[model samples]
Target: MTDGNPDRPVIVLVHGAWHRPSTWDATRAALAGLGYETRIATLPSAGTDPSPTASMYDDAEAIRREVDAVDGPVVVLAHSYGGIPTAQGLTGADNVTQLIFLSAYLLDDGESMYSRHGMDAPADTSGTFPLPENPGLALYHDVPEDVATQAVADLVEQSLLSFTGTVTRAAWHDIPSTYIVSEDDRSIPTALQEVMAAHATTTRRWAGGHSAFLAAPERFAALVDEIIRSR
Candidate 1:
Protein backbone atom coordinates (compact mmCIF):
# COMPACT_ATOMS: atom_id res chain seq x y z
CA MET A 1 0.00 0.00 0.00
CA THR A 2 2.70 2.46 -0.91
CA ASP A 3 0.19 4.42 -2.91
CA GLY A 4 0.25 7.25 -0.35
CA ASN A 5 -0.89 9.63 -3.04
CA PRO A 6 -4.64 9.70 -3.28
CA ASP A 7 -4.37 11.93 -6.34
CA ARG A 8 -2.09 9.83 -8.56
CA PRO A 9 -4.88 9.90 -11.11
CA VAL A 10 -4.91 6.69 -13.16
CA ILE A 11 -3.00 3.88 -14.78
CA VAL A 12 -4.02 3.32 -18.40
CA LEU A 13 -3.73 -0.25 -19.64
CA VAL A 14 -3.32 -1.01 -23.31
CA HIS A 15 -3.59 -4.68 -24.30
CA GLY A 16 -2.08 -6.44 -27.29
CA ALA A 17 -3.67 -8.41 -30.12
CA TRP A 18 -5.66 -11.62 -29.59
CA HIS A 19 -6.73 -10.20 -26.23
CA ARG A 20 -9.28 -7.75 -24.89
CA PRO A 21 -9.71 -5.32 -21.99
CA SER A 22 -11.06 -8.12 -19.80
CA THR A 23 -7.65 -9.72 -20.00
CA TRP A 24 -6.41 -7.30 -17.34
CA ASP A 25 -9.00 -8.33 -14.78
CA ALA A 26 -6.53 -9.54 -12.19
CA THR A 27 -4.11 -6.66 -12.38
CA ARG A 28 -6.84 -4.05 -12.20
CA ALA A 29 -8.04 -5.38 -8.89
CA ALA A 30 -4.56 -5.09 -7.48
CA LEU A 31 -4.18 -1.47 -8.54
CA ALA A 32 -7.54 -0.72 -6.99
CA GLY A 33 -6.27 -1.79 -3.59
CA LEU A 34 -3.38 0.68 -3.70
CA GLY A 35 -5.68 3.67 -4.13
CA TYR A 36 -5.12 4.10 -7.83
CA GLU A 37 -7.64 4.19 -10.66
CA THR A 38 -7.17 1.88 -13.61
CA ARG A 39 -8.53 1.63 -17.13
CA ILE A 40 -8.13 -1.32 -19.50
CA ALA A 41 -8.58 -0.41 -23.17
CA THR A 42 -9.27 -2.96 -25.89
CA LEU A 43 -7.83 -2.42 -29.30
CA PRO A 44 -10.60 -2.21 -31.90
CA SER A 45 -11.20 -5.66 -33.27
CA ALA A 46 -8.10 -7.36 -32.06
CA GLY A 47 -9.73 -9.80 -34.47
CA THR A 48 -10.65 -7.46 -37.32
CA ASP A 49 -8.54 -4.31 -37.34
CA PRO A 50 -6.69 -4.24 -40.67
CA SER A 51 -4.02 -1.58 -40.53
CA PRO A 52 -1.81 -2.06 -37.46
CA THR A 53 -0.48 1.47 -37.16
CA ALA A 54 -3.78 3.18 -37.75
CA SER A 55 -5.87 0.79 -35.69
CA MET A 56 -3.41 0.73 -32.82
CA TYR A 57 -2.61 4.43 -32.94
CA ASP A 58 -6.27 5.33 -33.06
CA ASP A 59 -6.93 3.13 -30.09
CA ALA A 60 -4.05 4.77 -28.22
CA GLU A 61 -5.34 8.21 -29.11
CA ALA A 62 -8.57 7.30 -27.42
CA ILE A 63 -6.56 6.32 -24.37
CA ARG A 64 -4.54 9.55 -24.48
CA ARG A 65 -7.68 11.60 -24.75
CA GLU A 66 -9.14 9.73 -21.83
CA VAL A 67 -6.00 10.32 -19.79
CA ASP A 68 -5.85 13.98 -20.72
CA ALA A 69 -9.39 14.34 -19.52
CA VAL A 70 -8.03 13.38 -16.12
CA ASP A 71 -6.01 15.62 -13.73
CA GLY A 72 -2.46 14.21 -13.42
CA PRO A 73 0.35 12.18 -14.93
CA VAL A 74 -0.75 8.80 -16.29
CA VAL A 75 0.98 5.49 -15.92
CA VAL A 76 0.57 4.05 -19.43
CA LEU A 77 0.86 0.29 -19.60
CA ALA A 78 1.31 -1.85 -22.68
CA HIS A 79 1.31 -5.61 -22.90
CA SER A 80 3.17 -7.46 -25.68
CA TYR A 81 2.77 -5.67 -29.02
CA GLY A 82 0.51 -3.20 -27.29
CA GLY A 83 3.78 -1.40 -26.56
CA ILE A 84 3.92 -0.49 -30.23
CA PRO A 85 0.62 1.33 -29.99
CA THR A 86 1.39 3.04 -26.68
CA ALA A 87 4.74 4.22 -27.99
CA GLN A 88 3.36 5.74 -31.15
CA GLY A 89 0.25 7.21 -29.57
CA LEU A 90 1.97 8.99 -26.69
CA THR A 91 4.83 10.51 -28.68
CA GLY A 92 4.17 14.04 -27.38
CA ALA A 93 1.68 13.47 -24.61
CA ASP A 94 3.23 15.35 -21.70
CA ASN A 95 0.78 14.00 -19.16
CA VAL A 96 2.23 10.51 -19.28
CA THR A 97 4.51 10.07 -16.28
CA GLN A 98 5.76 6.57 -16.96
CA LEU A 99 5.51 3.78 -19.50
CA ILE A 100 5.26 0.19 -18.35
CA PHE A 101 5.91 -2.53 -20.87
CA LEU A 102 4.92 -6.02 -19.79
CA SER A 103 6.66 -8.67 -21.86
CA ALA A 104 5.74 -6.45 -24.82
CA TYR A 105 6.93 -5.70 -28.34
CA LEU A 106 8.86 -2.43 -27.79
CA LEU A 107 10.47 -0.88 -30.87
CA ASP A 108 12.76 1.98 -31.72
CA ASP A 109 11.67 4.92 -33.81
CA GLY A 110 10.75 3.80 -37.35
CA GLU A 111 10.71 0.11 -36.37
CA SER A 112 7.81 -2.21 -37.12
CA MET A 113 6.47 -5.06 -34.99
CA TYR A 114 7.10 -7.36 -37.94
CA SER A 115 10.71 -6.28 -38.09
CA ARG A 116 11.22 -6.98 -34.40
CA HIS A 117 9.59 -10.41 -34.26
CA GLY A 118 10.60 -11.28 -37.82
CA MET A 119 8.30 -12.65 -40.55
CA ASP A 120 8.71 -16.22 -39.30
CA ALA A 121 7.93 -15.51 -35.66
CA PRO A 122 5.65 -18.17 -34.23
CA ALA A 123 1.90 -17.54 -34.19
CA ASP A 124 -0.18 -19.37 -31.59
CA THR A 125 -2.93 -20.18 -34.10
CA SER A 126 -4.56 -22.72 -31.81
CA GLY A 127 -7.27 -20.08 -32.14
CA THR A 128 -5.65 -16.65 -32.38
CA PHE A 129 -6.13 -16.47 -36.14
CA PRO A 130 -8.72 -17.69 -38.62
CA LEU A 131 -11.10 -14.89 -37.91
CA PRO A 132 -14.37 -15.62 -39.67
CA GLU A 133 -12.08 -15.10 -42.66
CA ASN A 134 -9.01 -17.03 -41.42
CA PRO A 135 -10.69 -19.71 -39.39
CA GLY A 136 -8.37 -21.89 -37.26
CA LEU A 137 -5.92 -19.02 -36.88
CA ALA A 138 -3.86 -19.28 -33.68
CA LEU A 139 -3.38 -15.77 -32.29
CA TYR A 140 -2.66 -16.29 -28.60
CA HIS A 141 -1.24 -19.78 -28.15
CA ASP A 142 1.57 -18.72 -25.89
CA VAL A 143 -0.87 -17.26 -23.39
CA PRO A 144 -1.85 -19.59 -20.51
CA GLU A 145 -4.45 -22.30 -21.20
CA ASP A 146 -7.35 -20.49 -19.49
CA VAL A 147 -6.39 -17.19 -21.11
CA ALA A 148 -5.97 -18.84 -24.51
CA THR A 149 -9.44 -20.37 -24.29
CA GLN A 150 -11.05 -17.03 -23.47
CA ALA A 151 -8.88 -15.25 -26.03
CA VAL A 152 -9.97 -17.70 -28.74
CA ALA A 153 -13.56 -16.98 -27.89
CA ASP A 154 -13.31 -13.17 -28.13
CA LEU A 155 -10.30 -12.70 -30.36
CA VAL A 156 -10.52 -10.60 -33.54
CA GLU A 157 -8.68 -10.59 -36.82
CA GLN A 158 -5.66 -8.30 -36.43
CA SER A 159 -4.32 -6.09 -39.20
CA LEU A 160 -1.15 -7.47 -40.76
CA LEU A 161 -0.34 -3.91 -41.79
CA SER A 162 0.07 -2.91 -38.12
CA PHE A 163 3.12 -5.07 -37.84
CA THR A 164 4.38 -3.79 -41.17
CA GLY A 165 3.79 -0.17 -40.19
CA THR A 166 6.72 1.65 -38.63
CA VAL A 167 6.35 4.06 -35.71
CA THR A 168 7.18 7.56 -36.85
CA ARG A 169 8.82 8.45 -33.53
CA ALA A 170 10.01 7.08 -30.19
CA ALA A 171 7.91 8.44 -27.34
CA TRP A 172 9.82 6.75 -24.53
CA HIS A 173 12.78 8.93 -25.36
CA ASP A 174 11.47 11.46 -22.86
CA ILE A 175 9.12 9.56 -20.60
CA PRO A 176 10.62 7.54 -17.78
CA SER A 177 10.22 3.84 -18.61
CA THR A 178 10.04 0.51 -16.84
CA TYR A 179 9.78 -2.98 -18.33
CA ILE A 180 8.51 -6.16 -16.71
CA VAL A 181 9.69 -9.42 -18.20
CA SER A 182 7.96 -12.74 -17.70
CA GLU A 183 10.72 -15.22 -17.06
CA ASP A 184 8.65 -18.11 -18.35
CA ASP A 185 6.77 -16.58 -21.23
CA ARG A 186 5.92 -19.15 -23.89
CA SER A 187 5.07 -16.83 -26.78
CA ILE A 188 7.88 -14.25 -26.81
CA PRO A 189 10.53 -16.48 -25.24
CA THR A 190 12.00 -14.97 -22.07
CA ALA A 191 15.40 -14.71 -23.74
CA LEU A 192 14.12 -12.47 -26.50
CA GLN A 193 11.98 -10.51 -24.07
CA GLU A 194 15.09 -9.79 -22.08
CA VAL A 195 16.82 -8.63 -25.22
CA MET A 196 13.90 -6.47 -26.25
CA ALA A 197 13.67 -4.73 -22.86
CA ALA A 198 17.44 -4.24 -22.73
CA HIS A 199 17.17 -0.52 -23.29
CA ALA A 200 14.46 0.09 -20.71
CA THR A 201 15.55 2.64 -18.10
CA THR A 202 14.19 0.36 -15.40
CA THR A 203 13.35 -3.36 -15.46
CA ARG A 204 11.49 -5.83 -13.26
CA ARG A 205 11.10 -9.59 -13.57
CA TRP A 206 8.34 -11.93 -12.48
CA ALA A 207 8.01 -15.70 -12.69
CA GLY A 208 4.87 -16.27 -14.71
CA GLY A 209 3.49 -16.68 -18.20
CA HIS A 210 3.20 -13.79 -20.65
CA SER A 211 -0.15 -12.76 -19.20
CA ALA A 212 1.08 -12.53 -15.64
CA PHE A 213 -1.53 -9.96 -14.76
CA LEU A 214 -4.05 -12.78 -15.26
CA ALA A 215 -1.82 -15.67 -14.27
CA ALA A 216 -0.58 -13.88 -11.14
CA PRO A 217 -2.52 -10.67 -10.77
CA GLU A 218 -1.52 -9.62 -7.27
CA ARG A 219 2.18 -9.52 -7.99
CA PHE A 220 1.70 -7.63 -11.23
CA ALA A 221 -0.58 -5.14 -9.56
CA ALA A 222 1.87 -4.58 -6.74
CA LEU A 223 4.55 -3.74 -9.29
CA VAL A 224 2.30 -1.27 -11.06
CA ASP A 225 1.41 0.42 -7.81
CA GLU A 226 5.06 0.67 -6.92
CA ILE A 227 5.83 2.41 -10.19
CA ILE A 228 3.09 4.97 -9.65
CA ARG A 229 4.33 5.64 -6.15
CA SER A 230 7.92 6.17 -7.25
CA ARG A 231 6.98 8.49 -10.06
Candidate 2:
Protein backbone atom coordinates (compact mmCIF):
# COMPACT_ATOMS: atom_id res chain seq x y z
CA MET A 1 0.00 0.00 0.00
CA THR A 2 1.21 3.47 -0.80
CA ASP A 3 2.07 5.39 2.34
CA GLY A 4 0.02 8.49 1.43
CA ASN A 5 0.25 11.90 2.98
CA PRO A 6 0.19 11.41 6.72
CA ASP A 7 -1.55 14.69 7.39
CA ARG A 8 -4.75 13.71 5.59
CA PRO A 9 -7.20 11.09 6.75
CA VAL A 10 -7.80 8.11 4.47
CA ILE A 11 -11.15 8.21 2.66
CA VAL A 12 -13.05 4.95 2.86
CA LEU A 13 -15.64 4.56 0.10
CA VAL A 14 -18.68 2.29 0.26
CA HIS A 15 -20.57 1.89 -3.01
CA GLY A 16 -24.36 1.58 -3.21
CA ALA A 17 -26.37 -1.51 -4.16
CA TRP A 18 -25.84 -3.16 -7.54
CA HIS A 19 -22.47 -1.46 -7.77
CA ARG A 20 -18.94 -2.78 -7.34
CA PRO A 21 -15.90 -1.00 -5.97
CA SER A 22 -14.92 -0.19 -9.57
CA THR A 23 -17.87 2.20 -9.69
CA TRP A 24 -15.79 4.49 -7.49
CA ASP A 25 -12.81 4.55 -9.87
CA ALA A 26 -13.27 8.10 -11.06
CA THR A 27 -13.99 9.53 -7.65
CA ARG A 28 -11.11 7.64 -6.08
CA ALA A 29 -8.71 8.84 -8.77
CA ALA A 30 -9.84 12.40 -8.23
CA LEU A 31 -9.34 12.07 -4.49
CA ALA A 32 -5.88 10.65 -5.07
CA GLY A 33 -5.00 13.65 -7.21
CA LEU A 34 -6.08 15.83 -4.32
CA GLY A 35 -3.46 14.17 -2.10
CA TYR A 36 -5.74 11.89 -0.11
CA GLU A 37 -5.41 8.13 0.30
CA THR A 38 -8.52 6.03 -0.25
CA ARG A 39 -9.85 2.55 0.50
CA ILE A 40 -12.92 0.60 -0.57
CA ALA A 41 -15.21 -1.63 1.51
CA THR A 42 -16.65 -4.26 -0.81
CA LEU A 43 -19.94 -5.45 0.65
CA PRO A 44 -20.51 -9.19 0.52
CA SER A 45 -24.22 -8.65 -0.08
CA ALA A 46 -23.45 -7.42 -3.58
CA GLY A 47 -20.88 -10.05 -4.50
CA THR A 48 -21.02 -12.84 -7.11
CA ASP A 49 -22.64 -15.39 -4.82
CA PRO A 50 -25.20 -17.44 -6.73
CA SER A 51 -27.37 -17.53 -3.63
CA PRO A 52 -26.21 -14.63 -1.55
CA THR A 53 -26.77 -15.18 2.16
CA ALA A 54 -24.89 -12.13 3.40
CA SER A 55 -26.97 -9.62 5.35
CA MET A 56 -26.43 -5.97 6.18
CA TYR A 57 -24.58 -7.21 9.25
CA ASP A 58 -22.11 -8.99 6.99
CA ASP A 59 -21.62 -5.86 4.97
CA ALA A 60 -21.21 -3.96 8.23
CA GLU A 61 -18.49 -6.36 9.29
CA ALA A 62 -16.71 -5.81 5.98
CA ILE A 63 -16.83 -2.07 6.51
CA ARG A 64 -15.62 -2.38 10.08
CA ARG A 65 -12.66 -4.45 8.95
CA GLU A 66 -11.75 -1.87 6.30
CA VAL A 67 -11.83 1.00 8.79
CA ASP A 68 -9.95 -1.01 11.35
CA ALA A 69 -7.12 -1.59 8.86
CA VAL A 70 -6.51 2.11 8.48
CA ASP A 71 -3.96 3.29 11.01
CA GLY A 72 -5.02 6.93 11.36
CA PRO A 73 -8.09 9.14 11.15
CA VAL A 74 -10.64 8.02 8.56
CA VAL A 75 -13.61 9.51 6.77
CA VAL A 76 -16.26 7.14 5.46
CA LEU A 77 -18.31 8.17 2.42
CA ALA A 78 -21.27 5.89 1.75
CA HIS A 79 -23.64 6.09 -1.21
CA SER A 80 -27.28 4.93 -1.51
CA TYR A 81 -27.87 1.59 0.25
CA GLY A 82 -24.22 1.58 1.24
CA GLY A 83 -25.13 3.97 4.06
CA ILE A 84 -27.18 1.35 5.85
CA PRO A 85 -24.25 -0.99 6.39
CA THR A 86 -21.86 1.91 6.86
CA ALA A 87 -23.90 3.18 9.80
CA GLN A 88 -24.08 -0.19 11.48
CA GLY A 89 -20.39 -0.91 10.86
CA LEU A 90 -18.79 2.12 12.45
CA THR A 91 -20.81 2.04 15.64
CA GLY A 92 -17.91 2.21 18.10
CA ALA A 93 -14.95 3.04 15.84
CA ASP A 94 -12.95 5.81 17.46
CA ASN A 95 -10.72 6.42 14.42
CA VAL A 96 -13.61 7.42 12.20
CA THR A 97 -13.53 11.21 12.13
CA GLN A 98 -16.57 11.81 9.95
CA LEU A 99 -19.16 10.24 7.71
CA ILE A 100 -20.37 11.60 4.38
CA PHE A 101 -23.63 10.20 3.17
CA LEU A 102 -23.89 10.80 -0.56
CA SER A 103 -27.53 10.58 -1.51
CA ALA A 104 -27.51 7.60 0.85
CA TYR A 105 -29.95 5.95 3.22
CA LEU A 106 -29.62 6.99 6.86
CA LEU A 107 -31.66 4.64 8.97
CA ASP A 108 -32.06 4.74 12.72
CA ASP A 109 -31.74 1.87 15.17
CA GLY A 110 -34.18 -1.02 14.62
CA GLU A 111 -34.97 0.31 11.13
CA SER A 112 -34.35 -1.69 8.02
CA MET A 113 -33.91 -0.28 4.51
CA TYR A 114 -37.24 -1.82 3.50
CA SER A 115 -38.91 -0.21 6.50
CA ARG A 116 -37.48 3.17 5.53
CA HIS A 117 -39.30 2.85 2.21
CA GLY A 118 -42.59 2.12 4.00
CA MET A 119 -42.35 -1.56 3.09
CA ASP A 120 -42.46 -4.33 5.63
CA ALA A 121 -39.32 -6.33 6.19
CA PRO A 122 -39.32 -9.60 4.27
CA ALA A 123 -40.14 -12.61 6.44
CA ASP A 124 -37.81 -14.75 4.31
CA THR A 125 -34.68 -12.82 3.33
CA SER A 126 -33.26 -15.30 0.87
CA GLY A 127 -32.42 -14.72 -2.81
CA THR A 128 -31.24 -11.51 -4.45
CA PHE A 129 -32.87 -8.27 -5.53
CA PRO A 130 -32.51 -7.78 -9.25
CA LEU A 131 -31.46 -4.48 -10.74
CA PRO A 132 -34.00 -2.18 -12.34
CA GLU A 133 -34.70 -2.64 -16.05
CA ASN A 134 -32.81 0.52 -16.93
CA PRO A 135 -30.41 1.08 -14.07
CA GLY A 136 -28.38 3.61 -16.12
CA LEU A 137 -31.39 5.86 -16.45
CA ALA A 138 -32.06 5.86 -12.74
CA LEU A 139 -28.50 5.96 -11.39
CA TYR A 140 -26.23 7.54 -13.98
CA HIS A 141 -28.59 9.68 -16.02
CA ASP A 142 -26.27 12.66 -16.08
CA VAL A 143 -23.15 10.66 -16.83
CA PRO A 144 -21.75 10.24 -20.33
CA GLU A 145 -23.54 7.67 -22.41
CA ASP A 146 -20.67 5.15 -22.68
CA VAL A 147 -19.77 5.43 -19.05
CA ALA A 148 -23.37 5.03 -17.93
CA THR A 149 -23.85 2.03 -20.21
CA GLN A 150 -20.79 0.33 -18.81
CA ALA A 151 -21.87 1.02 -15.27
CA VAL A 152 -25.30 -0.48 -15.92
CA ALA A 153 -23.75 -3.54 -17.50
CA ASP A 154 -21.48 -4.00 -14.48
CA LEU A 155 -24.33 -3.93 -11.99
CA VAL A 156 -25.02 -7.02 -9.88
CA GLU A 157 -27.90 -8.40 -7.85
CA GLN A 158 -28.04 -7.30 -4.23
CA SER A 159 -28.90 -9.71 -1.40
CA LEU A 160 -32.47 -9.47 -0.11
CA LEU A 161 -31.23 -10.13 3.41
CA SER A 162 -29.21 -6.92 3.32
CA PHE A 163 -32.31 -4.81 2.93
CA THR A 164 -34.37 -6.79 5.44
CA GLY A 165 -31.70 -6.56 8.16
CA THR A 166 -32.41 -3.88 10.71
CA VAL A 167 -29.72 -1.57 12.02
CA THR A 168 -28.78 -2.47 15.59
CA ARG A 169 -26.68 0.66 16.00
CA ALA A 170 -26.08 3.85 13.98
CA ALA A 171 -22.60 5.34 13.96
CA TRP A 172 -23.81 8.69 12.69
CA HIS A 173 -25.66 9.23 15.95
CA ASP A 174 -22.30 9.44 17.70
CA ILE A 175 -20.12 10.72 14.83
CA PRO A 176 -20.17 14.03 12.98
CA SER A 177 -21.71 13.51 9.54
CA THR A 178 -22.54 15.41 6.38
CA TYR A 179 -25.28 14.45 3.96
CA ILE A 180 -25.09 15.32 0.27
CA VAL A 181 -28.41 15.27 -1.50
CA SER A 182 -28.57 14.78 -5.24
CA GLU A 183 -31.54 16.95 -6.13
CA ASP A 184 -32.18 15.20 -9.44
CA ASP A 185 -31.69 11.64 -8.22
CA ARG A 186 -34.28 9.25 -9.60
CA SER A 187 -33.13 6.10 -7.80
CA ILE A 188 -33.65 7.66 -4.37
CA PRO A 189 -36.21 10.47 -4.49
CA THR A 190 -35.12 13.96 -3.57
CA ALA A 191 -37.75 14.17 -0.85
CA LEU A 192 -36.51 10.98 0.71
CA GLN A 193 -32.95 12.32 0.60
CA GLU A 194 -34.11 15.39 2.46
CA VAL A 195 -35.74 13.29 5.14
CA MET A 196 -32.59 11.22 5.59
CA ALA A 197 -30.45 14.32 5.57
CA ALA A 198 -32.20 15.39 8.74
CA HIS A 199 -30.12 12.80 10.58
CA ALA A 200 -26.82 14.37 9.51
CA THR A 201 -24.87 17.19 11.13
CA THR A 202 -25.08 19.24 7.90
CA THR A 203 -26.61 18.85 4.45
CA ARG A 204 -25.52 19.96 0.98
CA ARG A 205 -27.50 19.71 -2.22
CA TRP A 206 -26.05 18.81 -5.61
CA ALA A 207 -27.82 19.29 -8.92
CA GLY A 208 -27.42 15.90 -10.55
CA GLY A 209 -28.55 12.30 -10.65
CA HIS A 210 -27.89 9.65 -7.96
CA SER A 211 -24.30 8.85 -9.04
CA ALA A 212 -23.27 12.44 -9.62
CA PHE A 213 -19.69 11.65 -8.75
CA LEU A 214 -19.48 9.56 -11.89
CA ALA A 215 -20.64 12.54 -13.93
CA ALA A 216 -18.25 15.03 -12.41
CA PRO A 217 -15.57 13.31 -10.42
CA GLU A 218 -13.22 16.21 -9.83
CA ARG A 219 -15.98 18.45 -8.55
CA PHE A 220 -17.27 15.74 -6.25
CA ALA A 221 -13.77 15.10 -4.91
CA ALA A 222 -13.32 18.82 -4.32
CA LEU A 223 -16.53 18.93 -2.33
CA VAL A 224 -15.35 15.97 -0.25
CA ASP A 225 -12.07 17.75 0.33
CA GLU A 226 -13.87 20.87 1.47
CA ILE A 227 -16.02 18.88 3.85
CA ILE A 228 -12.99 17.17 5.37
CA ARG A 229 -11.06 20.42 5.69
CA SER A 230 -13.97 22.10 7.39
CA ARG A 231 -13.53 19.81 10.38
lDDT of 1 at 48: 47
Q: Would you list the C-alpha lDDT of every candidate in the order shown?
A: 0.70, 0.91
Q: How far in Å is the alpha carbon of 82 misplaced in model 2?
A: 0.4
lDDT of 1 at 52: 33
How many times do residue backbones clash in model 2? Answer: 0
Cand. 1 TM to true fold: 0.80
Assess candidate 2 and give its TM-score to the true structure.
0.97
Clashes of 1: 18
State the lDDT of candidate 2 residue by residue for 54-132, as single tens digits: 8899999999999999999999999999999999989899999999999999999989888898898767778998787
* Candidate number achieving the greatest lDDT relative to the actual structure: 2
**Which residue runs does candidate 2 get wrong by more than 4 Å?**
1-3
